[model samples]
Target chain A: MTDSPPREPRRLTRGEWLVIAAPAAWIALFFLAPFALIVKISLSRPAQARPPYEPVFDLASGVAGLLEKISQLGFDAYRGLAEDTLYLDSYLSSLTTAGIATLVALVAAYPFALAIARAPQKWRPILIGFAVAPFWTSFLIRVYAWIALLKDEGIINHALMSLGVIDAPLPMFATRGAVIVGIVYSYLPFMLLPLYAAIEGQDPSLREAAADLGASPRQVFLRVTLPLSKRGIVAGVLLVFIPAVGEFVIPDLLGGSDTLMIGRSLWNDFFANRDWPAASAAAVALLALLLVPILLYERAQTREGRR
Target chain B: MSARVLRNATLALGFAFLYGPIAILTAMSFNASRLVTVWGGFSTKWYSALVHDERMLQAATISLSAAALSALIATFNGLLAALALARFGAFRGRSLFAGSLYAPLVLPEVVFGLGLLLVFVALDVERGFVTLVLAHAAFTMCFATVMIHAALKDCDPTLEEAAADLGATPLRAFILVTLPLIAPSVVSAYLLAFTLSLDDFVIASFTTGPGATTLPMRIYSQVRLGVSPEVNAISTLLLGFVALILTASALLTRGRAKGGGAG
Candidate 1:
């Protein structure tokens, strides 16, 4: 965007080096190294010990020993994950729950995003700010709030009972429906913000032109507004879906035992079973599964930014 | 007119769904009934009980300290990373650094927490406050970097160049001219980091050691048993605290903008 003159190629100064080195090294060591370690552990045998896995590499072992230890890494964890129906079921359930939650969030957030986008200019900022305010409140507490309202004797059931809507309090706590509610409530903002941006940035003239051409409001939205906001819809879905898929807290707190999610299983492996290799394998598998959506989201973001 | 009415109705219902549970929880906090579902009457008994709860107090202290320390450290490093990405022209391995920095944002907490815990175990680094701070700072730094990078992108580059042209060193130019312009975002970055750390449970569950349970972890344990009015009390207080800070900052910014506009 700038027409500034190109500067001569010069070596970076110590100050510049200082600026780059710290965060670069920190991320490399802490973030990248840990991820690499998880991959390494996932390839190893689960051993009952302090580390909970046979070391993928032993520095004490010399050249031949190093080669043997390197060869020791196998696909046992992957095989176990594949062979176990529990693991497979958890993965499937996690995907289904996340998928359903994402769709619900999209439906709920679209109207809110459209409202904020089409609101008067004077009220836009305040309305958007209020929309985002609840997110700042603790996420866990928000989920917990549902327990108070969703339990058999909870507010919803109590209100329903009092109004003679039912003879008994409905079973709502620790149900799949409760889990979906928790997911939707917590992730509504993630969907709305992106949708609002997409909808708001759209040209009003196109919509007006459609309306002027005798297109119905619903027709105009489906043809123009919806198509135009496709980027936001994609972004919002991925944002809600990816996190929901691997979410540990929501499913654990709000879901029944029957509501098996890969996150909860992974946590169980790590803490309850103390099986680091298996847990690492679950994490690796989860990441591998999410790789496509993550890459797609990033590409969408970059393309949007370029525009 | 019907279309407008439909839009407004949709908006009102959306807001109601979003805020309903929170409003109920806040109201429940003040209920005299010990049971969460039963609202006997209005009272501050739960708040008084929350005040005397020693475990909650300790967890609150640990969470606040870790959040404060992590936010400060992350903000500093994040500002540097933002400068490296935004101001400094593309350098060697810039893409790699950028990718690694942003990887944490989408990475599931299970992956990150397990990986980091493995690292600490491999390194034989004891898990405690130090570990929590390190992990929190690492992830929160990414968020801070993103926020500051956006702010820097919007700022005029010439402002820094002007300062440099007026006999200031590059560092001085950044500190004197560029930093002021992005100060609001920097503050926001810190707030974001703080809240993220404070609210984090999954990672804290994995990384925390003996006697280092965070407030979220505490709340998680209590919530698992069932809804306790005490949990509501604490949640309400925390909610109030967040609301106060946000509203105050919003008003402060609005007042400043009005003053500037008048001037």
Candidate 2:
């Protein structure tokens, strides 16, 4: 690199303080405080009425009691979650569904990201904008479109009947397959966007250098392009997987009773069942599961950012 | 594989998959039939009915105000955070601070929404438009930060230094030099915040008080009631509004950059 000025540390003045304070304070109160609040509620017993958390124990109860109490938070919710087979089943199902959805999305989006990376400069924006088209509409509308298509006598059936492909109209809606389709349809862009950014950032010169050295196209791609884009793959998976894990809308609309995911369970506990503490616990546990990706993504971005 | 063939097929397929359903919905919005998803002929009858729907109209106005207000607050906070992040890297706890802002972006909306609902309840704050706006601004800041940080990381600091050398104060230099150069990201960030707020349902559901419903909440309620072509009409109109904003922005940038050769 190009380095002109000698490196020196400079203290931040009042101006810098002014720049950072507002955003920090806002995030602290609303974002961070609420997470702490949920964690607190998760430790408490279920509330039947308004403000549905009761503290597990006061701090003055002693360090031993507090630690034991904090650890019991999971079991407290788990006991309730297990007793209600629906809640437990949904949690497990959502995890599997989200995992499968992420796998499908990665398979689908990778080649597209590669294509966009190698696209002609002139058509790039047009293609990219098209990639972003789904995001331009309301999320509910997109899911509804799937509903329109996947209903038993919906457009898919209509098209298939006209073509005389099946003797019976296939049952497409309210199935695992339909739910997966909805998840993939909604998250396809999320997978593509990061993968595109990462793949595009990889220098094209490396591929040329590999070719110049008499490497075959497949060898160059497998050995060079794929490895270089692993970071993108990770980022893509994370982006798709985390949200898919907590997906409520698609499952709520398209999924059958068997498609019990954690999100819908959490939704029911609070809204339908009116078990606030258990709901808060399920939600917190979901948040805890999500924290893994959130923390990982933050760490990766920060690490990448420093360079 | 040949890059041209590979790219063409991938681009065409990807675009079709992404945009195809949306196009269908848009077309059906104007379908001159009682069947919502079935095709018959084209007319604007659904759109006309959408305008007359009092509930949807009220929700739209509420959503617009919420989006605009939250976006303004998010932009202000995001710009400053980006500035501090890009310039003042000397501070300890920078990553921690950044993480706090960025956490909401990655945390599931279900979790974040639940957490915020708890916080509001704990604080005994009434959940309504005010609560909705506060929560929206809080989480939307993550998007603003990401957009601006991406822009700032690529920006050359030499421009600011040059401005400073020419007798500009740090504040003046940033206003005159840095802001103008990075304004595209600001617009992009604002656009992102707008969409996130406009599309927010989970958070709004948790925090929005009675009768302070936004469009997504309204639509979700309507969907639970039953699917209707009226939803399609409302969606089509909203889509058109976003498209218009993006088009105007592009044209404005084009005119401003006239023959500037990618400055």
Best by lDDT: 1
Question: DockQ numbers for every candidate?
Answer: 0.59, 0.55
Cα deviation at B128, candidate 1, in Å, is: 0.5
For candidate 2, write residues A1-307 as lDDT tens digits: 1111234445567888888888878878887788777767766776655665566666678999888877766457656766877776777888889999899999999998888878777766667666865665578778877877777777788888879998688999889888888999998888888888878888889999999999999999899989998888888888888888888888998888778888888888777877677777787778767778866776677666656
lDDT of 1 at A196: 94
**Residue A109 shift from truth in candidate 1, angstroms:** 0.9
Error of 2 at B238 (Å): 1.2
Per-residue lDDT tens digits for candidate 1, residues A1-307, read: 1212145334556889988888988898779989898999999998877777887886787888889887767789999999999999999999999999999999989989999899887988888888888887789999999988888878889889989999988998888888999999998999999999999999999999999999998999999999999989999999999999999999888899988999999999989998888899999999998999998887776566555
On residues B1-263, what C-alpha lDDT tens digit does candidate 1 reach at each position? 88688878888888898888899899988899877656699999988988899999999999999999999989999999999888776455665677788888898988999888887887899999999998899889999999889878877898888888899999899888888777877887888888889889988888889979999999888989998989989999888877776776566556545644564
CA deviation > 4 Å runs, candidate 1: A1-13, A60-62, B248-263
Candidate 1 C-alpha error for residue B73, in Å? 0.8
Report the lDDT tens digits of candidate 2 across residue range B1-263: 57687678877887787877778878888888757546778889888888788988999999999999998899899988888878886565565677677778677777788888887887789989988988898888878887788678767899899989999999899999878877877887787788788988888988889969999988888777555788878888877877776665455444434523456
Which residue pairs collide in model 1, if any? Answer: none
